[model samples]
Target: MSVLSAKFGHRICGLKDGRLRDIKTSSSNVRNMEELEAERAAQKIEYAAQVKMEQRIHNKLKIVKQQFNSILQSWHHSMHQLRGKVPGFV
Candidate 1:
C-alpha cells in the first residue's frame, strides 16, 4: 500500500511540474510585453520633444531670413542713390 501511495505522489508532482513551468513562461511573457510598452512610450515622448525643437529652429530661421532681406533692400536703395549722384556710373 505504501509503495502505491509513493508512486501516486510522484505522478502528481510530475504533472504539477509541467503546470509550474507553463505559469513561469506566461509570467515572463507578461513582463516582456510590459517592458516593450514602456520603451514605446518613451520613444513617443522623445519624438515629440524633437519635433518641437525642430519647429522652434524653423521659426527662428524664418525670422533671421526676413531681417536679412530687409537689410539687403536698404543697402540696394542706398546704392541706387549713390549711383544717381555720380556722373556716367553704370
Candidate 2:
C-alpha cells in the first residue's frame, strides 16, 4: 500500500501513539525549514560584507599605486638637476 495509507491505518490501530508521532514529525519539519531559511539569510549578509571589504582593498591599492608613481617622478626630477650640474654629463 501507499505510505499515506499505511500511516493512516497505523494511526487508527495505534491511535494515540501514531497521532503523537505524526504531529511531532510535522512540527520538526517546520522547524527545519525555518532554520534553513535563517542560515540562507545569514550567508547572504556575510557575502555582502566580503564584497564591501574587497572594494575597500581595491581603493587602497589604487591610492598606494598613485603615491608610488608620484615619488618616482620626484626622484627623476632631482636626478636630472644633479646631472645638469655635472660637466659633460650626457
Candidate 3:
C-alpha cells in the first residue's frame, strides 16, 4: 500500500496490540519545535557565511581584472612607442 496506509496500519496495530498507548502530545512537542528553530538558525548562519565568502571572492576578482588591464595597456603603449609613433617611453 501507500506510505500513509502503511503508517496508519502500524499505528492501529500498535494501539490494539498493547505496543503503544493513548497519550496526549502537548508535553512532547516543545523539543521538536526547538530543534526546528535551531535548524533555521543554523541555516541562516550558513547562508550569511556563504554570502561573505562570495563577496570576498568578487572583490579579489575585480582587483585582479584591474591589474591585468593595466598591464595590457602598458604593453600596448610600449609596443606603439617602439614603432616610433611617439619618440618617448611613456
Candidate 4:
C-alpha cells in the first residue's frame, strides 16, 4: 500500500521495507528522502563558501608578493647606485 503526503511528496511507498513488516515495517522504511537531499544541498553550499574564501586568501597573498618584489627591486637598485659612487667599494 502507498500513502499520499504533500510534504514528503505526492506518493510514498516502502518498496525496501520488506513489504513493510506486514505494513508497520513498510511504513517505517518509507522514510523521507527530503532529509538526505537537504543535507546534500547544505554540504554543497558549505563547499562553495570554502572555495570562495580560499580564492580570496590566494588573491590577497598574490598582492602582497607583488608589493614585496617591488620593494626588493628598488632596494637592490639603490645599493647598486651606492656601490658605483664609492670608488673603493666593489
The model with the greatest lDDT is: 4
Better of 2 and 4 by lDDT: 4
What value of lDDT does candidate 2 attain over all alpha carbons? 0.70
Candidate 1, residues 1-90, lDDT tens digits: the string is 111122211311224334311112355566676799899999999999999999999999999999999999999998899899998866
The lDDT per prediction is 0.68, 0.70, 0.68, 0.71
TM-scores for every predicted model: 0.66, 0.65, 0.62, 0.62
- Cα RMSD of predicted structure 3: 7.5
lDDT accuracy of residue 26 in candidate 4: 35
Q: Pick the candidate with the highest TM-score.
A: 1
Sort by lDDT, best first: what order? Answer: 4, 2, 1, 3
lDDT per residue as tens, model 3, 4-85: 1222113222444345443333434645656898999999999999999999999999999999999999999889878787
On residues 15-84, what C-alpha lDDT tens digit does candidate 2 reach at each position? 4435422222355665676799899999999999999999999999999999999999999998899889
In candidate 4, the residue pairs with backbone N, CA or C atoms under 3 Å apart (3 or more residues apart, or in different chains) clash, namely: 20-26
